[model samples]
Target chain A: MTGRTIRIGAGAGYSGDRIEPAVELAEQGKLDYLVFECLAERTIALAQARRRADPEQGFDLLLDERMRAVLPACRANGVRIVTNMGAANPASAARAIVRIARELGMAGLKVAAVIGDDVLDQIREQPRSLSEHDGTTADLGDSVVSANAYLGMAPIVEALAGGADVVVTGRVGDPALFLGPLAYEFGWSADDWDILGRGTVIGHLLECAGQLTGGYFADPGVKDVPDLARLGFPLAEVSPDGSALLTKVPGSGGRLSVACCKEQLLYEILDPGAYLQADVVADFRTVRFEMAGPDRVRVTGGSGRARPDMLKVSIGYQDGFIGEGQISYAGLGAVARGRLALDIVRDRLAITGIDAEDLQYELIGLDAVDRTGRTGIEPREVRARAVGRSRSAYAAGRIGAEVEALYTNGPSGGGGAVASVRQVLAVTSVLLPRDRVAPAVLYEVA
Target chain B: MLLRDLAHVRTGDKGDISQISVILYDIENYALLADRLSVEVIRRHLCALPIFSGERYELPELGALNFVLRGALSGGVTRSLALDAHGKTLGAQLLDIEIISIS
Candidate 1:
């Protein structure tokens, strides 16, 4: 409430797919803040693989080369950016961003790396218990592929408050990046739950970048939405009374209408009455949307309740190890032949004295009938996969090694040869309440 | 459907869908828009496609019409056509309606 109205923009395009276009918009000098969301569950494994290949590599390496073109203009224009492109390696991503800043001759720009979310090490040290929503306890003895804490806006607010112009973070609550700017600019305290909830709603609205800017409007007749190939992301100009205006860079692709803004507002919310996030539960029912202009929408009438005492936690663990091999079959009964091959493999594993609990099998291309009527289809070809799990990683690895012996010893009446078995880690998930896990035990690595 | 008669249409978000609330000039005109336009009339004629999924609704208070769509997020499945990511685009497409206001 003490600061001037600050406008912040966020977009959902990836650097590999839409980097150049985003850079062009940055050169236009239209935004006060920009946030880029580039991380997903699968992206975490990819980052881990890269770090394993070369420990010196960082998370931003996954962004591809196209983003390099835009760093200079972004720095020159003073449009501070917050990106989760750091993935699991925030220090590496921060170092890369700083290197880019230096190469562009932009000096004295403070870049803050918001770390401590990657909790794999901490989970191992303490080995806490987690229960599911159904009240079942998750088994931690299984192998866990990856685990990271979903950080909230407080760390981000701390980064910005430290006078860092560009903030880079790992897996954080997607909406928190946008809300962090609000908290920093307005001096909103952590205990201001109502305003924090309202800010989170605004962040969710603009989180997808182009959705609020008319990229997905249902209206049939709003014409000429600018350069769609270079669509600009959206910014929310918020007032202390909890009203906001959604707009994008001028001359960018896409249009902004009440319809488009409302569409983004409802995405992924489980309950309209209580739209929950890591920080708060935003009430979408109390919100209102109005058409302010050709490419602008005014969002008002948003009200917030209180926040939950416990923070929702995401816990991941090793489920098992899996090995998959594929072969093509032609002509009649292709699916039948594939099923036969699977039975032979299972028989072979049993013959080797592998316990039933230690093994699992799946056929990707088979048809099965159920109450729903024809649950799956028989494709032209099928990829059969087998998985194994045990208390030890070596036992799982041995199961993967056994799959390759089938290529020469069993099945194979016709068709192509079975590929060599590839060992893969298995992962599972559970959720725990705030009290069971302590955040103080996890320390940020500089 | 007559473009001028679209004045009674209203749009909003309900959960994961972008709902368009439309009321025809009268009960008889309801069939006219339904028969003439089809759902594509609104979708194809609209600028931001793929990112939005649509369904029609009826409101008796003002004789209104509504269409709710599934995906409206830019990076969501509506833009990429991926089944897993389309839910984010639902509400963004709800804000794109335009009517001539013929009352």
Candidate 2:
């Protein structure tokens, strides 16, 4: 029997977000669905590298851990699972889940995977300039790693309609993950733009999970949120009309208030009158929220225009590798020592011909984050950091090695020197003709 | 008085654009905030920043002002060398803007 009101919990916001809160929400929130919006901009590039190494892999790093933690509670509570944890590979992720269900001895757990977001090969054939930039995918050329289009809600709802217990996907729009359950439960029409717009609003609210529940919203004493240590994940009590009461589980740590909601409502948003997503162009300009009670706020007044004709594709490429090293200098003449360390690294890079595409020599305690070059007093200690993004890992490794050599090379009290290098995968967006992208869904039961 | 005394702030970024929302606690303060937080004023206030341009959008119903700062994050979180690459700290940077009461 379908419940009149569907409550879906936002299990995880980013890929590495806490798993314990998801367990708490699934076991106690009485949710019909738990959605995990895990993929971030550069994460897919890393996933692509995984797929290159092993075809059986290419899902979120925390997928197995998160699924293991949440599956028992969800299955026992009759809650369904939905996530974009599939990363670069939905099929493998689905098979993994099916296998996991068998291992857990929960037979007949239906799992569905939505595919076709990866369009790198197709994009390569027809290279075009990115959104606002002059460069095409061709310019990125052979360095191109992975290409994925942000999909909408239709495929997810299709999977849910087929009686799947869990839905795993790759590169669906963040809001589309949450909107799927609402459309599935409320039986909302696919073309119901206003309802979709309202659903989009809730999806945006719950997309980041803890953010709406005061995770990033807290300011101690000034704008206080209680019990933030054990902050609760968000669950929307969504109704048929595409409106919902935004709240969290009782006794949860974080505060759910209009102040918090307002911030998240506009978070990462540009042109509030027209928030273009895969499904609809949601308008939150007229959005209003009122507290129904403590931690209970009713959100309403969102409308929609037509969806965009093109879908945004996140194109990840091997931008090169970043090498970084840091060394600390303390006591008198620390500022001078830090300056000397930076100068040495600079000179070393110049002498070594490590012509990095981008290089930074920062006196960390002074001008690292703030570019103002303001040091109130010559800090008692300052850390000199040298970083460079270069074409090769070998070149990237040298920037730090050059900095570490400063210890024996002598700049006075150069201690705690460390160096490391890692491949850098950069991301940029390009619009693809939506019709050219064919998203498909398949279901399997273990 | 500090902008924080009158309003709460949130910051978001897209590519190089830093989107900031200044939401007032009281609906009445919208007028004062609207009058005070102008494009020129904000541009000048944040002139010390590495950003290139600023544009503002007002939502009076929600008692909020949305400011989109272009070239703010250098190249954004993925590639920017800034520690706060996403420009998440821009809100606190913005809250530092003082709004003297006309009264």
Candidate 3:
């Protein structure tokens, strides 16, 4: 049964995705492996910085909560777990999981830790001008927060092969979490490009836990999804050759349709023919998604190419500080008052010689970030917002303070004044020689 | 009418780039979106934003068009000071674009 097909359930999509559905999958989905992909582009960097601050930290914030919620159920059902929730500190996370398993009386549970993605020192050794063409890459100095490479499925497959009840990883490609178990159970060779490619396409679909099951596909009347409050996460039934049936926990809320499957297949892929990852270049050009049954889609015809020689690294650095202030205007001429409020803050920054590196002023309801939602008509109320960026947090705080001062000194009808200042952890991409970095694994049997 | 009238959107992000997929409910609208959602048209429609370059890859079998908008994230999720760091709303913004029906 394990050789021919394996059932895998997506537990959590991101670090903070809903977990109740994952518990449902563990209790009822009959999954062989439950994969939780909780890492994002910036999450690992933030996690690494957190680890630097203190030991026994730097894991996913909800790690303990998620494990406590689902570990007992998963152990009772004999369902193994594979996850990239270790974030910046896989060892610490693995140690904690060992403690949790012992506490839950499942002392035999084996958790594997995959590490060596961190390469900040390596990045600083060979500094070069960033390749991002945007103006934002300028003025990036010596303050780097974290540098971690996007690891592949090699170490994870090793853990699964070594009889690990749970595989913990940090900074792996999203699809790698799913592909590792698929590769291990199916015994597909690492160099098997076609199977790996097909597996990656499935991993991509399942990576964003509830996306394929209709969590993000709902609209009021145009694209309606029913009972979304009880939306179920996705699970895949894969054959040895990488052909799979995508479905969800039966009786769950969301609808699984061709639209959801197709959108997910194309999500985050730059070129369908050349979706580059550390393991293989997944090609989705010839893939197909057909309705196999109700709430089930059959996926097939995926292939891959040779792996890239260079691996992309996401580097996090202390970029700057952001200061923001918002004040709401209500009454007959709220739009005008909101507009005037923004003007006052913009002029106040200049008049006070606050040389903020970048500044933006917006009428909240009319325009937020881009020139979006700008209709000719005016609403009864609008919030005026001003954001300033600077090298110093104090200077950034001053920009927001100036806007707050208008609450008492000026801007009639202004209420709900708020201001905030926060440090920015900026991210950048650089290519590292693939051979220069390696993924190593450690196992802890409770 | 708006693109959202005929299709739904899904978003993904990579550094400074934002990828939005416009998937039509009915496969019949594939030709319409393929014909209308061109580089020049999208560039012109999204001129207000700081888009350095745009690439459109069409999947006829899936009935979808994937747009990779470089420099769309206002720098990036962590780097950008924008409230919506990941440019999660770009797909909604694209859906709001006026589509001249190919009927």
Candidate 4:
């Protein structure tokens, strides 16, 4: 083990669900590095829509206020912070961080913004005749909500190497935050795939903070832990040989257990034998986890192969319009009545010559078996629902109007009440190979 | 069927679905329980009526027996509702399973 150990502190709880307790742990631990990850598909769409409405409102700026409250305590204890909370806009996020650092009177603080993962503009720049691989002509009929490329750790590593205390990035791989620190500390090159892969795994393990440290463990009985409202997040003390010990802040709530570690290990990964990321392919099966102490699980004996040549690109497009409405049914045969009401509405729409592209109907609260041919007695009440798509919003609205009419015309209409309809923006996604989205296409906006 | 019998149960809709996670301790024990009770036993004892039209089976990856039910509500009365079949079953089915576990 090297004396200059590479310690990694993972920041979690950004779903606004568990962030407060997670943040408290970071402040109390006096950690070397703090990382917060806050990105999801739907979140990207929402952020993009906000950016379109106002360029400055893209990223999750709410974190700024939260971070501001903690920055003083973190600075006082000399802890550095890194986060992907930048979301769609990194420079803007960095600017906010800079202001906070200055306000805190932290001298010699360097804030770096890692950008260039968004490729929405590039996708548009291509000739209008370009196809989407399946021979379907590319069409931007509706507004483009979001377009972000998933980048690796190079930019973040560069930011850290340039002496930046806080690194803010947009749409970076979750593991990149953890990998960036290792690369900067060990002087690992971009192509040094082996160590980079190990570092990526370390990042993946620690990304969710308390997750590996026992936040969602089935065993070790986490429910019995005291003060879960103030649970501490996990941090890894990684060695040069790619070995790591997982532990949380002292005096924290959760306990580190083998079951919790395994649960997190199995979360999003599709294949344990081939865990693919932009940097490396880590083999989780070869990796071993041992409970070292009270809140410490030692991670070791992991191996890696090579990375896939093509990077997985997430492309979103406009599919069509969708709308939905719900109605409630009560009393005898409630489940059957709900289903009958749905059929009545569909039959009414068909008779009215409504040409919806597709239609779906469901009866909730019905004592109905699943696709496996299981059945049960009808419930006392059931919620009937339907969904469909059309070429225009007007066509979609027609479906909603018809559903409302059913309250008076359908069998269950005597008692059933129709809820207001909701219209959804249509979105679809496709994957393009790495070669299609070349690095030259990416650029930083001043 | 006991909660432990549902070591792996996948519940989702046509294309997109959210995870309704249930962790079980033993796979073999759960499989044996599933074989004895099947979906019929679950519905009779648990009061969870199957909603979808197609045949549902167990998916090992989800670590739970999965049933892909169709025509379930998308939280609305129109076919354009965002609620999928699997999501509609969550409330009644999960409660039924919980009752079975306690019993």
lDDT of 3 by residue, A264-349 (tens): 88888888888998889999988888998999999988899888888878878787899999899987899888888888888888
Q: How would you encode candidate 4's per-residue C-alpha lDDT over B1-103 as one tens digit per residue?
A: 5353344222323223222333344444445544453544443543333233423344333233333333343322222244533353442344234324323
Error of 3 at A185 (Å): 0.8
At residue A319, candidate 1 shows an lDDT of 38
* Candidate 3's TM-score: 0.96
Q: Model 1, which residues run further than 4 Å from truth?
A: A1-3, A13-17, A63-67, A125-142, A214-227, A316-446, B1-103
Residue A406, candidate 3: C-alpha displacement in angstroms: 1.7
Model 4 chain A: weakest 10-residue lDDT segment is A437-446
DockQ, prediction 3 = 0.65
Candidate 4 residue-wise lDDT, A138-182, digit = tens: 455445556666677778777776777778777777888888887
- In order of DockQ, best first, we have 3, 2, 4, 1
C-alpha lDDT of all candidate models, in order: 0.57, 0.88, 0.85, 0.60
Q: For model 4, what is the alpha-carbon lDDT of residue A318? A: 47
Model 3: per-residue Cα lDDT at residue A206: 97
lDDT of 1 by residue, B1-103 (tens): 2354343333443223444444343445545455444356566544434425555443332233445555532222111212222333322222333432324
What CAPRI grade goes to candidate 3? medium
- Cα-lDDT of candidate 3: 0.85
lDDT (Cα, tens digit) per residue for candidate 1, span A1-446 = 33367777664544344564467556763666778877654456556667778775648654435336656666677777777887767767777767766766777767777776766665565654553223222245434545666677877887777777778887777888888888887878776777877788788787767666756443455333555766767777787655787777677777787646554665444345566666776666566667787677888765456656545444433333333344445456766766666677677767777543435455544421111113345576665555544444555454545555556654564344443322333222344354443322111212
